[model samples]
Target: MSTASTKKPPEVRLPPKPDLELRLDKFAQLATIFLSLVGLLFVLKTGSFLLAPVSLAIVVGLMLAPVALRLEDIGLPPSLSAAAVVLIFVLVTGSIAAAIAAPLASWAARVPQIWNELQLQLQLTSFSEPLATIRSVREEIRNVTGEPNVTVSVQDGSPVESVAVLAPALLAQVLIFFASLYFFVATRHDTRLAILKMCSGRRIRWRAAHVFRDVEGLVSNYLLSIAIINIGLGVTVAVVLWLLNVPSAPLWGAIAGVLNFFIYIGPALMAVILLGVGLASFDGMPGILLPPLAYLALNAIEAQIVTPMTIGKRMTLNPFIIFLAVAFWLWIWGPVGGFIAIPALLILFALARNLIPGFPWGMPEERRRRLSRLP
Candidate 1:
C-alpha cells in the first residue's frame, strides 16, 4: 500500500537549451581560434632559423617592391630588376656594417672592464645593502638545506669550433633570404594575380586584390618613412654625443637608430646603454645623468612631435597595441622580431580591412565623431 501510494518515473535528461547551445558553439569557435594561434606561434618559434630570414626577406621585399617596379617601368626585366634591388640592399647593409665595425670592436674589447666598472657602480647604489642581504639569505638557505656548493665548470670551445658550428646555418639562412627576396620581388605581381584567381567568388577576389595592394603600399610607405626618420635621429644623436665629448659617437648613434625601431623597449635600452657609456667615460654623477637625459629629451621630441607628423594620423597605431605587438614578437624572435613587428601589424591591418566586412581604415574624423555620439 505504501509503495503503491506514489511511484513516479525518473525525469529524462533533455538536450541543452537553444541559448546554451549557442553559447557553447561560440565558445568552441573561440577555443579553436586560440588553439590555432598557439600552434602557429609554436611553429614560428621552432622554425625560427628558417622562418626568421624568410620573414625578413618578405618584409624587405615589400619595402623594396616599389623600387623594383620602377626599375621594371624603365623596361628592365623582373629578374634584372629584382637583382638590382637585392644588390643595392646588400651594398647598403655592407656599408652600415663596415661603418660600425671599428667602434663596435673597440667596445667589445672593453667588455670585462665595463663589467667591473658596472659592478662597482652598482655596489655604490642605495639598493646594494638589500642586494647583499638577499645574497646572504640565499647562502643561509643553501647551508640550512645542506646543499653543497656545486662548481659547474663549462669548458670553452675553440673559436673556430664555435664559428664552424654556426657558419653553415648562418650561410644557409642568408642564402634562403636572398633567394626568397629575389623570387618574391620577381613574382609579386603574378603571385597577386594567382591569389585573386584562386578566390571562389567576385567578392573574395576583390577582397584579395585589395589586401595585396594595401599591404604593399602601407608596408612600403611606413618602412621608408621610418627609415628617413631614423637616419635623421641617428645623425642628430651622433652630433650630440660628439659635442658632449662621448667616445664612439657614431657607434652609439647607429645603435640608437637601430634600437629605436623596437619602440618602447629600444629607447629605454638605449638610455641604459648611454648611462653605462657615461659611467665608463666620466667620473661625475652629472656626466652619467647628462647622456641619458639628453637622449630622453630628443626621444620625447621625436616620439611626441616628429613621428606623429611624419607617419600621419592614418598610419599611427595605438600605443598599447604597439607595445603588445613588440613584446609578443620580441619574446618569439628576439631583436629581429622587434624589427618586423610594426610591418607585420601593418600587414594584418590591411588583411583585416579587406577581409572583414565594414572594417574601418583609420576610423576617419567624421566616423569617430559619429561613434562619439553613441550612448
Candidate 2:
C-alpha cells in the first residue's frame, strides 16, 4: 500500500486507430479489381457473336490486303479495289467448297464400311489385345447397365446435305466479314490518323503506328504463307490417297486443308480418319497404317521444314502462348475460334508488346532465340 501510494501510475497509452477512409479505400480497390475480372469473363462468354465477325474481318483483311494494294496500284479506287478483292475471294472459296462436296458426301456415306475395315485391321495388328480388352470393357458396361443389346453407331449422313444446310450461315458470315474488311481497308489511313489524335503524346502516337504496321505485316504474311503451305500439304495428301486408291481422295485432302488451320489437333484427327478409311478399304494392318504414316510425314515436313522456312524470323510467337490462345478461343467459340486463334494471338501480342515495357511481345530477339533452340 505504501509503495503503490508512492509510485505514480504510468500513463496508459493506446495505439492510434487505423484511418477508416484508407481501409475502406483499399477494400474498394480490391472489390473493383474482382468485379472487373468478372465483367471481362462475362464479356468473353457472351461476346462471341460480335467477336466472330470482327475476327473474320481481320483475317479477311489480311488475306485481301495484297490484292487490294495491287488493284490500287493499277489505278483503281480503294473502295472499288477492296470490293474486287472480296468478290474474288468469295468466288474462289465457293468454287472450292462446291468442288469438294460430292467427294466428301461419298466418304460420309461409306462410314459404316470404314468402321468395319478398321475393326478388321485392329484384329490383325498388335492392337488386337487392346481391342479385345475394349470389347470386354464394353461388355462389362453393358452388364452393369443391364442392357446387353446396346450398340454404338458412328455413321454420318450426306456431307452434301450438311454443307447445303450450313451454306446460308457460311454465306452470311462471309458477307459480313468481307463487308467489314472492305471498310477497314478503305479507311485504314483515316483510322490511324484518328488513333494518333486520341493518343496523349508524340511518343505514344509513334509507338502506336509502329505497332499497327508490325501487326499488319505479320498477319498478312502469316495468312499468305499458311495458305500456300496448306495447299501444298492438301495436294500431297490427295496424291497419296489417290495412289493408295482411297475413296474420295479429293474430299480427304480438302478436309486436311481445312483441319490444318487447327495445328496439332487437326493432323491427328485427319490421321484417324485416314486410318479408318484405309482399314475399310484394305484387309491388312499395313494398309491401315499407311494413312497415319503418310500424314505424319507430311505434317513433319510442314511443321519442321515448310513453316519454319517460309515464316522465318517474322512469325515470332511463344508456343505455349499459342496453345493457350487456341484453347481459350476454342472454349469460347468452338472450332471457329480455333481456326482464328493464331491471328488473334498475333494481334494481341503486338498490342501487349507496344503497351507494356517489360513484356516480350513477340519481338525479334525473342523469336530468334526461340528458333535457335528449335531442333
Give me candidate 2's TM-score against the actual structure: 0.73
Please, what are the lDDT tens digits per residue for candidate 1 over residues 218-291? 99998999898888898899899999999888889998897788777789999988987888897766777788
Instruction: State TM-scores per candidate.
Output: 0.82, 0.73
Residue-level lDDT tens digits of model 2 in 89-115: 779988988887766777788898887
- Quick one: how many clashes does candidate 2 have? 0
Could you tell me the lDDT of residue 39 within candidate 1?
100
Top TM-score model: 1
